[model samples]
Target: MLWWRQDDDERETDDEVEVRGRSVLVLISHYFPLLEVLDLSYPLHCYHGAVELSHLKKLRKVNFSGHSDINDKSLLHLFKSCKVLEEAIMLHCFDITFDGIAKALRERPTLRSLSFSKTNGPVKVRYESAYTTSHFISSLSLKCLASLDLLSSNISDELLSSIATERLPLTRLVLQYCIGIVQVLGICCNIRHLNLSKCSMVKLEMNFEVPKLEVLNLSYTNVDDEALYMISKSCCGLLKLSLENCNDFTKKGVNHVVENCTQLRKISLDGCHKVHANIVSSMVSSRPSLRQITAPPTRTGAFSARKVKYFLRQGCLVC
Candidate 1:
């Protein structure tokens, strides 16, 4: 095959060609059939549903994030074609619709990690109704689907609640910048890590127990002292808690968490202007389980600086 067809004038300089467009895809599908990983992100030209990856049976991971040409037809093609497809990261793929995503999931239910951040929203959604939407999204009873990230999308509470109720084996859920999510009442018993940062109105409360939760991030959210209490009562196995930039909670709420979460190891309170330095010092002294602390900006005296060093020497990171 002609890898690089440089003209006579440019023969002296071997300018590396940018591997993009449908030609490169055709070559990979035909020649490199045994390729296990495929990344067709930010392509210079649109594939326009002209490629096939069915021959690449060993394909495990693929990234099509930020590819403008990725529409429903192309997405469905990939999922239906690749039998052993495990993980697909399609972040910022704007043309993807709810209908397309639902169909894709059905085709390749073995997907362990899937991301659809910054995709099409309600105003631009095409050929989808509430009934059809539920029919597909609820079909997310996929066996191996473990991690689901829907950042900066327009997913509503009802739909999100459905995913919660489906009882998928989700271990990590990142819903950062999803403004539609205000509450998740479903007990995320299997979730080991959860991030709800920048989701301003999210309240941390669930009906059932959260026995297996290990990490929780509520940064820049409207989570109040009451929310902290709810978490402390529920997620007793929580290992890390991040409340960065949150001002609604004071020492009262923090005390509940530090006291109740016996396994709590790491806590980040950076940009929390309300958390007094004294409270932090108290936590350092009292909470012996803490291994790392991201404290808010504080005016440190010589004695306090020495104490911080002392804590560091004692196998804990305080910064």
Candidate 2:
């Protein structure tokens, strides 16, 4: 995979040739077969031209993350050229629409994985209505997809349902900030890492069987103590858990974790306010196999006269 960054110099170049004096035509004329992945990232809102990329018949994976200028029209152009393309990650490129994505995926049958996470931008006249709800729903056509990361991308319910019932070959899926994902009643059969942080739903309420999941991050979500209890009863293979900022969890949730998920190696509770320092200390010392634990800072209480004297004796040290 080769990662390319677009710059203003690329845009200022003469129309006769691209910035590098090499277009997709030149690439196709030379290195055609060995190319598997091509990434064009960074320098936001860049017009990285991909209209000539149609020549690479063997191109599979393409990443356009962090490119704000390349919108639905550019994506359509790229997809029209690369027929064999599989995975495409377009994080922060908010100029995509349902019609464009659906048309492209429908035309390209070999596409597998499609990710659009954290694709947000400032208010602009040209790219105002780029990311539509329909565009997310259009992502349901890829049946061969194995992984998807739509974290913080404002996904919809129709999209999640498509993944659950579309007979997908998905293995690794992330739906972070997909506020509509209330129940995995039908999904989560083969997911490996399922992250639903900052989602809208208060309760997890998963009824489907996902025996293969290894990592589950539900931090900043609406899951309460009862929901955590249910997850502790299920999801035996969960290795890493993030329950930070979940206001509903109390000591009950902590106790549930201690009893279940004996193989958990890492846990993050940075913003969980209900958890006390004593419980956190116990978990840190008791869990022999625990590798990492992230918690928020603590404040000291009113000091006694003896404590004040001790502080005076042990002055602060500077490096």
Candidate No. with top TM-score: 1
Clash tally, candidates in order: 0, 3
What is the TM-score of candidate 1?
Answer: 0.86
| Candidate 1 regions with alpha-carbon error over 4 angstroms | 1-20, 43-50, 119-136, 185-187, 299-304
For all candidates in order, the CA lDDT equals 0.74, 0.64
Candidate 1: residue pairs that collide: none
- lDDT, candidate 2, at 248: 74
Pick the lDDT winner: 1
Q: Residue 238's C-alpha lDDT in candidate 1?
A: 91
CA displacement after TM-score superposition, residue 280 of candidate 2 (Å): 3.1
